[model samples]
Target: MAATDDFSKDNILGEGWTGTVYKGVLPDGSILAVKQLWRSSQSGKGLQAKMETLGRVKYW
Candidate 1:
């Protein structure tokens, strides 16, 4: 099953805070949700904030 097989509009499942999730069909016909992240401009400070958030999650 390849990732490309499941990326069609017809299989969309849901959306969330960050992006829309689509139900993808693998080459073998397995189902999976692929989250598409919305594009945003990230400044240095913003990137640092994200890194801090990730670190916190890792520690938690």
Candidate 2:
């Protein structure tokens, strides 16, 4: 299987050391960006830790 044409370079939104970000439209016309993360970078502060930190943030 392959990704849709919507995931091509023409729809590129931005990029980072982790992955290339792409802008995509669903069949329902909703817009969204897809991120492809690098497997080697999923350590250190993981998702649960990040979420816990975010949960502690006090908004003004």
- Each candidate's lDDT (Cα)? 0.60, 0.63
**Per-residue lDDT of 1-60 in model 2, one digit per residue for the tens?**
023364687877788776776776777876655665556465667755754764676634
Model 2 shows how many backbone clashes?
0
Reference-based TM-score of each model: 0.47, 0.59
Q: How does candidate 2 fare on TM-score?
A: 0.59
Error of 2 at 42 (Å): 3.7
Model 1 residue 50 CA deviation in Å? 12
Error of 1 at 2 (Å): 8.5
Provide the RMSD of all predictions against the true structure, rounded to 1 decimal: 6.4, 6.1
Best TM-score among the predictions, by candidate number? 2
Model 2 worst lDDT run, 10 consecutive residues: 1-10
Error of 1 at 27 (Å): 1.1
